[model samples]
Target: MKKSMTMMLLLLVAMFCNAQMQDPVKFTAQLKTGNTAEGEIVFSGKIQKGWHVYSTNLGSDGPIEASFHVDKKDGVELVGKLTPRGKEISEMDPMFGMKLRYFEHSVQFVQKVKFTKPTYSIKCYLEFGACNEEMCMPPTQVELNKQGKSPAVDGEAAKEEEAKEEAVAITDTAAVAVTDSAAAAAPAALDTAEVKKLWTPVIDELNDYDQPVSNSLFYIFLAGIVGGLVALFTPCVWPIIPMTVSFFLKRNKSRKKAIREAIIYGVSIVVIYVALGLVVSMLFGASALNALSTNAVFNIAFCLMLVVFAASFFGAFEITLPSSWSNKMDQKSEETSGLLSIFLMAFTLSLVSFSCTGPIIGFLLVAVASEGSIVAPTIGMLGFAIALAVPFALFAMFPTLLKSAPKSGGWMNVLKVTLGFVELAFALKFLSVADLAYGWHILDRETFLALWIALFTLLGLYLLGLFNFPHDDEGRRTNVPQFFLALASLAFAFYMIPGLWGAPLKAVSAFAPPMNTQDFNLYKNEVHPRFTDYEAGMAAARLEGKPVMVDFTGFGCVNCRKMEAAVWTDAKVADLLNQKYVLISLFVDDKTPLPEQIEVTDTDGSKRTLRTVGDKWSYLQRYKFGSNTQPMYILIDNEGKPLTGSRSYDEDISEYMDFLNAGLDAYANR
Candidate 1:
């Protein structure tokens, strides 16, 4: 109970820190009118003290480099790249693991655009990355869209209306521009201070309410501990514990020396694992981990690796190092003395247990590598090693405890087989990632669920002795623990049955394919994205006098699917989205080809071809909204004014209801 409370306290602290989160850098865009047909979009970024923005020319393998994109349209042409108009420092960035240029305090970037037509519209957006001592913010977008219109076509009518407006302006006597009777109701005008605040972008206000990214290190450490605990019960590690404990008791002259040496042995284990983590970090680093995890080729490779490990667990093969390595370590331990000997003994144990512990270590490292921080891998290793060493420490303090320990038996094989099934389940996650990345329809939501249902059901049957694997003892009777585990497996399979026809199944949403992937969805309260085009959705909302809700999502977004399964399924959220607002979903990862190839000036001014519908919508998202992260949500009125703040991947039901309700109130008040 005390441990549980400590865990809860840590969680609450994390939540509170997230609630008070603030960005260290802020950027705004303004259209400076230089001439009738051309103007420069000036992007000014105010970076807080100690925070810096990367320069515009870092290579692809480095941190996010600032750049601009001028979307291709008729009658508009980009003059040049986004030229930096501020002082820059050329130095090394630790997070980037390379030498590069960056700007501190503040910077200004400008892009020149020309309009051929007298009256025309054009869209442009800029992208950049920022970091401080601790954390690096995700790549952010800033939209700098501007347009021009021809002067009044009828001079007489314009003059008459202008004269009448001037008469009303005299009567009002206030400095505020009064065009109608509505302004006459107010007696006072805004002061200079208030006027300065009026031009702040609505997108910034929306972004101020974005959900915090919860990539907590504590949570990753907890995952490592859980993996280590599972490894403790495996055949190789469990049987060895008794012998290890007896050796320590018999070897030392006193209990104090024995305890000290055991402690050193445990430290050796932690050092070894942490060294491995450091090696991994040095090889690829945290900056590359995110891309490696999301890349389709990488996912395919990881999936195949897991499958091979699972095959070994199922007794198809044995994965082990040469016997000579362990024998050499044992021989060294006998020849050496003191701490070095004990360390060598621990090393021998690791080599001997490779067949069982290797897969767990691989999974743990893979899981932490995607967390986007250099320290994460080391922290994960520390947690796993500590958990693995706790039993060794306890045996030194109480040497006789191993006499009551469970002996190695077929039960350990049961644990091994259970882990094999789990590995198979996780392999699907990698496959799902690959499929979504490449737009393959083979692993749709229903199909993924069907496969899982069959797999888990077979596991349950095997646990109940209905079947046997290659190394299973013939006709062994099921024990109480095995029976309960089988029951759980079968129950989980039953739970997934409803997911075939579109039940949310929030439990498995993180692993299953998205609901949109399913061809049929009969969930009664489902809220659909009726408009895929942004302009059409806003136009419809204007006609109906309802506010617009735009869902910025991606085909590969796991959190988006989780939100649909968990939060959107709630009755209040569904009702608000379905009845009160026009819903538009913009998928940034859509793969359908566009009508023609268009040249793109990337963030670094490198030219690339934008040839897909996904590219078009992704360009629009950054060009108009100034955000690339998903699932991003924003509410706007018919006149294209923001109704409320933006939201991200958070699953708090009450908070979401308040978000929707606030938009409704703001729209009505507007």
Candidate 2:
């Protein structure tokens, strides 16, 4: 018993020693009120130990983040900015390599506060977590009221006190606790305060970011299969199946010879597609890949192109070049060396089916390019081309299978129309990105849902043979392929309907607006309750002395989607979001207008009213950051100071957490 007691005491002492082992960090924050009745807050964090803090480059799902809010009034605007002083550390995780910001000895995070009224004192809370090289502690929120005793001596001191209070209010226990029995019964609520206090600084550190790549690879592979299936229905590829089989049979005179030629043909197709991907990668380099994925201009262009492609698919007009171009290629193809003939044949088919294949190709390119890497687009295109080319190769291996393939007829046209609807539906996504970048309120959450509903409803009707365009046959029963795809489409449409009334479509959570933006939602509880509107968010920030994270994201932004699907799902990332940050999703494509009286001039000297949510956010993004990309996250200190060029998130969630933790650390010490 004596020995056991000695060991226990030693362990407790060691733990306490570890907790107190951290080097003292210095933090300073200031608050100021302006003529316009707004608030500005600033914070600077200084660390004595070699340990460094991260910048305000918070990810969707990451650690405890730095934030500020004003608890004194309503409609008081607060913005924030973080300046990081440190060296960058590069680390590789399973997903990607990323650079983290840290300091060895000392650094500072500054916060500025502003208000319409010249208030000199603020009562707020400061929340933070501490860690050494080996161990970490839970987060803690310090409730303190800061006031300069001699406001008349140094005006700056008064301002500084106010700012400190505003910064501290970020983690203030001022919120009225929900009294519902459900809140008490819920598992997450049991340790809410303790979790919030302990997790704040270490929020970014406690994450299971070690998911294997096999799942990601599998998802891509599955997408490839889906693309292949979609391609098989196109008129250009569908007719060729029968034609190739008959040609092989006639030329070979024997099954063996026919199979050999078919095999060669398939090999040529794969080579051609892969080469195309490589060539594109080589041409664009890394910068192009980055832009392809997130460039606002590119997204808008792609969106418009899809509209045109969809129109063609709907038989409004054929997007075809002169037949002479194909004839010339054919002649040249025949003259080329032996294997090149197969490539030429593949090229010929692509040209003949340009109208049918163009939209799919464009969609694939857009999806890949949004991953913000040079190799992403190339790999995506390779996947798509390979999927498309496989059928040709497979048919060559078993010409008999071609006999059972669906014949071309009215169903083909119906398929084209169906694809058109899909193309049109996806087009809005690009537009949404551009809208958000430019603040064009052309499509909000409600508007987007409404459009999707109409598009899918039409698709269901077309599938059931109740609706027909001039290009579609008026008489035809839905075939097996049509039946299945139509059913899937119909089911998807029905699924989205509930989302309009506030359903958490977790399966496609990555594809929709955040649950916060929905006016009506069913599954939301107190922990992650639905945000009523932008006004409510703004009002809360004014009242609580908390700064907001204006997330410039879009429904169709592929990178935005990828980040949601891949990065935010990490448990660490989710925890931070639920506890640390006040998330404000501003869809750039929302088509609502500010009052005409509220029209304002932008940095580019353009005058316009806030006609759309996208327009306002887009203008702010461009003028403020010179960037027009989806998944653009901006962290402002309570006084609206933009923390530009901080440590940001990419594919790696740890790095993202590093940014969040660093920002919070800076705020805590301040």
Model 2 misplaced stretches (Cα beyond 4 Å): 1-210, 248-258, 479-487, 519-524, 528-670
lDDT of each: 0.68, 0.51
lDDT of 2 by residue, 354-443 (tens): 767666766666655544346654565556667777777677777678778778877778867877887787787667656544444556
* Cα lDDT, model 1, residue 400: 72
lDDT of 1: 0.68
User: On residues 372-426, what C-alpha lDDT tens digit does candidate 1 reach at each position?
Assistant: 5677677777777888888887887887787777788887777778778877776
Cα lDDT for residue 192, candidate 1: 38
The candidate that achieves the highest lDDT relative to the unseen native structure: 1
Estimate the overall C-alpha local distance difference test score of candidate 2.
0.51
Q: What lDDT is reached at residue 654 by model 1?
A: 58
